[model samples]
Target: MRITENLIFSTVLQLLEERPVSKITVTDIVRRCQINRNTFYYHFAGMEDLVQHLLQAKTKEFLGLKRRFRRPVTFLFYMMLVASKYKTVVLNLYHSDMRGALEATIESICHHYTHLYMASLQKMNLSDTDRELLIRYWKTIASGIFLDWLKHDMEYDMPHAIKRICFLMAGNKDLSSFDQLKN
Candidate 1:
C-alpha cells in the first residue's frame, strides 16, 4: 500500500516537472503510474489530496535532518538546498493554482526550524511572549526570502546570499538590544 502511494507521489512530481499542477489530473497520474483509478482513489481522494500528502511528506523528510546546524541561517540554507534539488517542480507549483500548498510547506519548515533554533539558545532567557514573537519574526524572514527567490525565478546563488545574511547578522554587536526595548 505504501509502495503504491510512493509511486503516485513520484508520478505527480515527475508530471509537475513537465507541466503545471492545474494541467495535470487524476487520469494523467494513474495513467503514468500504470495504476487503475480505483487504486489511485484508494490512496488519495483527488489531486489536491495527493499534492497535500506529497508536501507533508516532504516536510517530514526535511524535519528528519539529523545533522545539527550551528545557526538557524545555516539550517535555512540547507532547506533551500533541498528545495533547489526540485527546481522545476517547485517553480511549476509556485506558478500553479496549488501555490498555497507549497507556501504552507515552506512556512511549516521555517516555523519548526525557527522554534528549534530558539530552544537551543537557552542562555537568552527570553519570556514566552518574546520567544513566540522572535520565532514568528525569524520564520517570516526565512519564508519571505525563499518566496522572493521563487518570485525571481531562482536565478541567483542562494548560498552566497545566505552567507551575506549570516555575515550581516553576526556583525550586529547589540543582539540583546531587543531585551532592552521592553524595559
Candidate 2:
C-alpha cells in the first residue's frame, strides 16, 4: 500500500474515538477518505486488520524512547505518556471482547526488549553468565513495567518513575559496552 494507508489508518483510529471499530465498516472508511471501497480493501482486509497494522506501526513509534541510564532520565514518564496517548485505543483493544490483541501488543513489546538484550550481549565481550544475567534482568524489568502500566490506572509517568526505579534495576555490570545501549 502507499503511504496514504498510514494516513487512512490514522483517520480510522481518530474515527474510532467517535465509534467502535466493529460498527465502522469499510464503506465508512471509504466515505471518510472520499475514496472507493477497493482502496480500503487494498490497504487492509477489514477493520480488524487495520487495527493490527496501526497498533504495530504505533508500537514501533512508541518503543523508540530513550531511557536514561547514564544520567537520571524519566524513562517511565515518557513511556507512560506514550502509552496514555493511545489510552482509548489500548483500553478498547484489551476490553473489546474480540481477541487478545491488547495482550499481544504488550507481550510483543516485552519480547522485543529480550531480543535487544540478547543482541547487545552478542556485541559485548562479557562472559556468558553476565550476559544472561542482564537478559534475565531486562525481561523481569520489562514485565514489571508492562504490568505496572496496566494497573495503577496507568497514570504514572513511566520515564519519570524510571529515574527513581532505574536504581532498582541497576547492577554492578561491566559498562565496557555502554555504547550498545547508548546507540
Candidate 3:
C-alpha cells in the first residue's frame, strides 16, 4: 500500500479513460505518476501486473458490500456508489475485450448475494438444488438488472426498487413476507 502505488494505479485508471489497455505502457503510468522507471518497477513489474493488482483491489472492494445489513437497498446504494466511482471504466470494460474484468466483478457480486440468499434458504430448509436454483436464478436476473440499471440510470425509490428485485426472485412465494421489514 505504498502511496506511490496508489498514485500509479489511479494514474493508470485515468489514462485508460483515453486509450485502450493494450496501448497503455509502464512509461505512461510513471509519467502520469511523476515517478521513475525504477520506482514503477519497485511497486509493480509492469502494466499487466499492475492491472491485475488494480482489478483485484477493485473487485475486492465491490465484494465487500456483503456486510451486515437488514435490507437489499443498501446493496443497491453500494452499486450506485460503484457506478459513480468507475463509470467510464465500467462502460469500457462492459463492452471491451476486457470481458474478464467485468465478469470478475459480476461473479463477486453474485457470490455475496448468493451468500445472503443461501442463509435465508437455510432458515426455510431448502434443498441443495433449491438453494442453488435460487442463487442461479437471482444471479442471472440481478446481473442483467444491474447492467441495465447502470447503463440506463434507472430511477426508483430505494425501498421500492429493492421490493421489485425481491419480487424478481420470489419463486412463487409471496414476497409480501418481507414487506414488514423495518425501513
Candidate 4:
C-alpha cells in the first residue's frame, strides 16, 4: 500500500469506530488524515472502493498468518485473534451497509485455509463437488461463528470457543476424519 493509501485506510478504520461506513464520506477521511479531498480521491475512487480495498488488504494479512502455523486449527485461532483485536472496526462494519465486505473477507480467508487443509490430507479422496461443498461448509461454519462473536460484542473467549467447536466436530465419527493427514 502507498503511504497515502495507508494513511487513508487507517483514517477510515479509525473513523469507522466512531461512525458507520455509510455515514463516512471521502471528505471526512481526508479531513481526519489532514489531507485534501483530491488526495483521498487519488488514493481511492470513493468510499465504497476504499472499503473494498481495505477488506481485501486486511484479508490478505490474515491469510498470510496461515504460513506461520502448521495446523489448520492454529491458523483458525489466529483468525479469531485478529477479529478480537479489531473488534471495534469489525462491529462498525457489521452494523453498516458494508457488512458484506466483512463477510466476504471472512469467506475468502476460510476458503483459502480450507484448500490448504484439504491439500494436507493426502489420502483423502473427495470428489470435486464434495470438495467444493466441504469448503463452503467450513467457510460458513467459521464465518458464522466469527460473525456471532461480533454480533454479541465479542464477549466470549473466542480461541477457547473455536477449539471446543473443532474438538466437537472432529470427535464426530460420521463427519469424516482427518486421520489420514500426511505427517
Candidate 5:
C-alpha cells in the first residue's frame, strides 16, 4: 500500500514539473502511475487532498532529518537548497491554488528550526510573546526570500543572496568584510 502511495506521489511530482497543478487531474496521475481510479481514490480524496498530503509528507521528511544546526540561518540555507532541487514542482505549486499549503510547509519548517535555535540559547531569557514574535519575524523574512526567488523565476544565486541577507541581518557594517558562515 505504501509502495503504491509512493508511486502515486512521485508520479504527481513528476507531472507537476511538466505542468501546473491546475492542469493536472487524477486521470492523468493514475494513467501515469498505471493504477486505476479506485487505487488513487483509496489513497487520496482528491487533487487538493493529494497536494496537502504531499506537503505534509515533505514537512515530516524535513523534520525527520537528524542533522541539527546551531543557527537558524543555516537551517534556512539547507531548506532552500532542498527546495531548489525541485524548482519546477515548487514553482508550479507556488502559482497554483495550493500555494497556501506550500507556504504553511515553509512556515512550519522555519518555526521548528527557529524554536530550536531559541531554545539553544541558554543565557537568554525571553517572554513567550517575545519569542513568538521573534520566530514570526524570522519566518516572515524567510518566506519572503523564498517567494521573492520564485517571483523572479529563481535566476539569482540563492546561496550568495542568503549569505548576504544573513550578514546584513547580523548588523555587519562592512559589506566587503562580510564572511559566509562556515557550516
Candidate 6:
C-alpha cells in the first residue's frame, strides 16, 4: 500500500515539474503511476489530499533531519539545504492556493525549532506569552526569508543567506534583550 502510494506521489511530483498543479488530476496521477483510479483513491481522497500528504511527508523528512542537529544554526543550515533541493516544487506550491498549507507546515516547524533554541539558552527566562511571541517572531522571519527566496525564483545562494542571518543575529548586541522576554 505504501509503495503504491509513493508511486502516485512520485508521479505527481514528476508531473508537477512539467506542468502546473491546477492542471494535474487524480486521473493524470493514476495514469502515470500505471495504476487504476481505485488504487490512487485507496491512498488519497483526491488531488488536494494527495498534495497535503506530500507536503506533510516533506515536512516530516525535514524535521527528522533537523533532529540530528543540536544547534539552531545547523538546524537552519539543513532546513535551507532541504528547501534549496526542492526549490521548484516549493515554489509551485507557494504560488498555488495550497500556499496556506505549506506556510502552516513551515510555521509549525519554525515554532518547534524556535522553542528548542530558546530552551537551550539556559540564561534566557521567558514567560508563556513571551515565548509564544518569540516563536511567532522567528516564524515570521524564517517564513518571510523563504517566501522571498521562492518569490525571486531562488536566484540567491541559500547557504550564504543562512550564514548572513547567523552573522546578523550574532552581531546584534541589542537583540540580547530578547533573551528575557518582558510582559
Best by TM-score: 1
> In model 4, what are the clashing residue pairs, if there are any?
none
**lDDT of each residue in 1-183, candidate 2, tens digit only:** 666797688788877776666667788888888888887888888888887888788778766753333211223344456667777665555556533676677656655656554664554687878766766655566657766667655666666566554444454255434423432
Residue pairs of candidate 6 with colliding backbone atoms:
none
Q: lDDT tens string, model 1, 1-183?
A: 999999999999999989988899999998999999999999889988999999998788778875565566777788888888999999998998779999989999889988888887778799999899988988998899999899888889877997776655556666545333211
Q: Point out where model 1 deviates above 4 Å.
A: 169-183
Specify the poorest-scoring 10-residue window by lDDT in model 1. 174-183
Ranking by TM-score: 1, 5, 4, 6, 3, 2
Q: What lDDT does the true structure give each of the candidates?
A: 0.84, 0.63, 0.66, 0.75, 0.82, 0.74
Evaluated at residue 71, the lDDT of candidate 2 is 17
lDDT ranking, high to low? 1, 5, 4, 6, 3, 2
lDDT tens digits by residue: candidate 4, 1-183: 388888888888889888877788877887889998877777778888899999988877766664744555676677777777787788888888788887888778877887777666556688878877766766676677777887787888888886676666667775436433211
Candidate 6 similarity to native, TM-score:
0.80
Compute the lDDT of residue 2 as modeled in candidate 3.
69
Cα-lDDT of candidate 1: 0.84
Model 3 regions more than 4 Å off? 17-23, 42-45, 69-77, 148-183
Relative to the unseen true structure, what is the C-alpha lDDT of residue 151 in candidate 4, on a scale of 0 to 100? 78
The number of the candidate with the highest lDDT is: 1
Per-candidate TM equals 0.88, 0.64, 0.67, 0.81, 0.86, 0.80
- Can you write out model 5's per-residue Cα lDDT over 1-183, one digit (the tens) per residue? 989988988999999989999999999999999999999999999999999999988888889986688766678778878888999999999899998888888888888877777666656577888777767876777677877887777778878998777657456657434232212
Model 6, span 2-92: residue lDDT tens? 7987787788888877777788888788778889888788888888899999988877776676474455556666677777777677778
Candidate 2: where are CA atoms >4 Å away? 63-74, 97-99, 114-137, 151-183
lDDT of 6 at 80: 76
